[model samples]
Target: MSDDDATGDTATKPGDDRGATYASFVAIGDSFTEGLSDLAPDGTFRGWADLVAEHLAALTPGFRYANLAIRGKVLDQVLEEQVPSAVAMGPALISLCAGNNDLLRPNGDPDALAKRLAKGIRELRATGAEVLLFTGVDPRDSPVIRHARGRFATYYLHIRSLADLYGCRLVDLWSMQGLRDWRAWNPDRLHLNETGHRLVAAKVLTALDVPDAGEWHKTWPLPTAPTASRTENARWAREHLLPWLGRRLRGTSSGDGLPPKRPNLTEWP
Candidate 1:
């Protein structure tokens, strides 16, 4: 399918009567925003942010976009490294998704993370851009991260509160049942797969009141077989889990030397 078809049929329509023409967009956060597991043919991640940008660009001429996100980045890194650049660009739309990495850590502090996130939102809003916030989906199907569901819930609630307080748009991933399915995830069972990213792009557009043809909340087909077996889980643990744990132990990150794929707010191709 074409990018327009995958994103939404109405995505190419001109801005609605509200005059919500997004001339530029900037996405800031971690691997989720960075598009991990949604690999392009060139081996780069073409995540929801990119898809959203493309959708908007098709509708608005001279629509520029930037994505300042890296994998395995905690909220602090995002606030410190990305927020400044995003503010400088001064895009009409900005989407921020962070704190999930921090929440995954032991003894994660939801309150503290929320405070930091709120500060960033406030700063972004000061720039007069429509800031978009996200609540991560529940990873109930993932044996490894499911344990942190309580923490995730706490953080998600806090995010909702911030969005309400700051008048920021919220993309409530937590309520998306489709994301809970293993089929939407990659081999690592962490990041969303290509289909998952497409759905997210559709949802984000919908949340922004951007015209789109695709439905983000559509139900997936029922599973024909049982979920992952013990043996399959074990293999996953060995391949994806152990390495992540090791990184935590050594205070290393998967995005150690990586740079944002689209750092500048250039016109979308």
Candidate 2:
């Protein structure tokens, strides 16, 4: 298990999707899950969902990901569509990063929203998947989005309660990254860029207890200012976690003895 291979630690776990391994992963959410406005089709996991998958693949080996996230899905959509798919997969791990759209969509009934979301979570967990739930991020200020100032605290509570009732791991990204910086947001302010995504990934890994989680969070720096330069973003990705993630997927290695570490950007160069 070396950093060079970046994936040697869990590269061939028993449940990995490849071969006979039964381990499969599914993501459930809205546009954020859809990787909206993300630079590439591959980067469609514009936020933490993709990052979590990337890290889990390293630890679980042969792990396969089935992103069931859809655009503009609210609580109802999740219960109707995403939840059923995830339940059928019987995934080893399920990440539920949703509910932002429920808050933004017009005429959403909060009580009904909570009820449906809870049911969706209950069903996912019933399939024996270890559920990892994520809280929503604050919307970036935008002209087209009319209700930017709407209260979202209730959604957070509902999500947290569901996770607790289901006995699942919860990553409060809204608290960890969202409330901390306006800079962490993209220009559109709706989704995350590379650094934002990396931070979220680091948080998720820490929750999962993969060995390298600590290093990923502690070593990475966060920049006080957002970078408009895609080059800088690309460079950061190449130098850290993203490159290692690439190596693992390709079955390559860094040749070093260290485990592949997640990159953080709390204080980036």
Candidate 3:
């Protein structure tokens, strides 16, 4: 379906609770799935996957969760390192969100990225897990990443297609109007902030036919003043954009030495 066509209601109705159906959930991908920017007090990222898992755990006794996602992981790395382990765990639910790191690379190919993503999804599905996929939020709000808006859109379209082909539930972030707001993003203008992650968790649950408090897409209160002024934009470029570009040029990644937060399918803390 076209992006516009796909922009109807969320995957499931409001107030529909289906959390009990899932006994376990494993999230795999890059920093986004690893929960960057949505940091915990102990200096760890706890993104939407953890939030969703917490809700699911509350509903089902002995619910297990694992997040095998590491920062800066490309699609190939995810397939090689994380996917196999996630499949071995045999969780009833799996959420995969990768390729943003690849998309940010110079001259990245969306089609090739989509193929890799599809392969991982298919492999996960082979384990009889209900896979969850995501279309990235539009990055146009960021001055730096906005240069590749066209490429990002193409990648998102491919992701939508893959979700359809695999019968995976999709958390269509591309169509979520709330994400377009700059406030939804972290200072790095890459990862989503705490509020943004919360919204994503709600959407993912809704996609899974789970019940939630019913306010994932609510618009933020209007900013009293303009946001992302020239000075702030310049600061962002210096602080976030330049470092990221340096990493890319040096052929390094943020996840260089970082291990997966929850390497095993264990009880949610």
Residue 160 accuracy (lDDT) in model 2? 71
Per-prediction TM-score: 0.91, 0.65, 0.90
Best by TM-score: 1
lDDT of 1 at 141: 64
lDDT of 1 by residue, 75-162 (tens): 9999999999999999999999999999889878887788777778778888878888999888776677788888889888888777
For lDDT, the strongest prediction is 1
Per-residue lDDT over 167-268 for candidate 2, one digit per residue giving the tens place of the 0 to 100 score: 777787666644345355555455666566667777776766555653323233576666446775556455654654565467443322321111111111
Deviation in Å, model 1, residue 50 alpha carbon = 0.6
* lDDT values, one for every candidate: 0.85, 0.57, 0.83
Superior by TM-score: candidate 1 or candidate 3: 1
Those runs of model 1 whose alpha carbons end farther than 4 Å from true positions after fitting are 1-19
Number of colliding residue pairs in each model = 2, 16, 1
